[model samples]
Target: MNQWSGVNALCYYLAYILEIYLGFSQSIALILASVAFTQYAVFSWPPYFYIDRIGRRRTVIWSSVGCAACMAIIAGCLLNSSYTTSAVAVAFMFLFLDCFTMGILPVSWSYSAEVQPLRVRNKATAVGVFSHWMSNFVVVMVTPIGLNSIGGNYFWIWAIICASFVPLTYFFGVETSGRSLEQIDQMFFEHPRWLMGVEADCTKVVKQTAEDEEMRHKAYAKYDGFDQKEKHVEVVHHEEAK
Candidate 1:
């Protein structure tokens, strides 16, 4: 999620950098930025439908790799400092944003929420959200400083981070795409690190159970007065029968 935040924060300043640093005209930079936005919106979803089909872990890892490669290309262009390289860098930035939207944006929340146990899921989600926002804040605050101090080479730091995330995800990422929350809990309990092969079983029963429990809790909390009234009515009926 920090990677998601960081990359997104960088994108806000990219047009300015392209215009000033890369010597692009304002109109050209605006066009590139608009194209980037279109790419972002277009690719942000549809991959989510395949999260189960393609497997979440693989999707995330490969997406990280793709982003890393894009970053590397962009960094290379900046390092070389030519008009051609600048154009290539602009293209790579669009590609990087596409990869981020497709892979990281969709799964970031679902993956975090799904991995947590039911009892603490809400708390976990809150923490996840906080962390995500915090990451965004830090990236937004630091990016300008980094850009000023280090110039285009600042992207190399993100590229390395993206590359590192790939292995970290592969080794630690649990397969929870097709499993029930209960199954996910059990898998974490038993293995805690990995799952084996071809597991896309639907989670209908588990989903129903969770929903029913949630409804029961809500109903009980809302109807304490009704419960007391029913009890009093039963007592009166018993007295009348006596």
Candidate 2:
């Protein structure tokens, strides 16, 4: 989960280096890239809406593969010296950014929000944001080195990086669709609980804990440490007297 999502978060950072490579119209291309990211972010929401439905594994796998192809295509476009190359490259690059941002980008945050205990949701969200930006900073600094390479060589490097992330997603990402939240718990946790021959709900861990505590008290039939039969007899006597 961390590996797939972490890489997806870094997609724009990698693309920033590749697409920002100076050329005939570099400044204009960059501004367009920024606009595309904001504008296209909406389309990517379908990925979010359906991620839990279609499942995280498929979404992550496809998004990583698509993002890789986009990078490779951008690199190929940049290699062309045609006057329209910059325009086409930026156009496609934004598409890839949009895909990543809306798709694999939010899955981990969703998981984090759902899985983290309520006491730490804010902290969990903060940590997620922090990790996101930290990676952003790293890629921002490192990407320039790729940019310094000869024309579009940065894209070639990013193409490789993008390609590498796909397999990482396939192997490490968990599927979260269709199954009850309990199944998702088994998929990631150290000790998965089985309830009456079925998996327990992962998302209901806190609720389950409360239920179990109440059940424990009922099972013993002991109010204030009274013996089980004594408690039962007392209840019966009270009912008869009524």
lDDT of each: 0.76, 0.58
Per-residue alpha-carbon lDDT of candidate 2 for residues 133-217, written as tens digits (9 for 90 to 100)? 7766666666556556665655666567666766665544444454434444555564343321133332222223456657766
Off by over 4 Å in 2: 1-27, 112-129, 178-182, 188-242
Best by TM-score: 1
Clashing pairs in 1: none
Per-residue lDDT tens digits of candidate 1, residues 44-78? 87796676767677778788998889988887788
Query: Which 10-residue span in candidate 2 carries the lowest summed lDDT?
Result: 196-205
- Which ranges in model 1 have alpha carbons more than 4 Å from their true place? 2-5, 193-242
**What is the number of backbone collisions in each predicted candidate, taken in the order shown?**
0, 1
Backbone clashes counted, model 2: 1
What TM-score fits each model?
Answer: 0.78, 0.60
TM-score of 1: 0.78
Q: Ten residues in a row with the worst lDDT in model 1?
A: 197-206
Root-mean-square deviation of candidate 1: 6.3
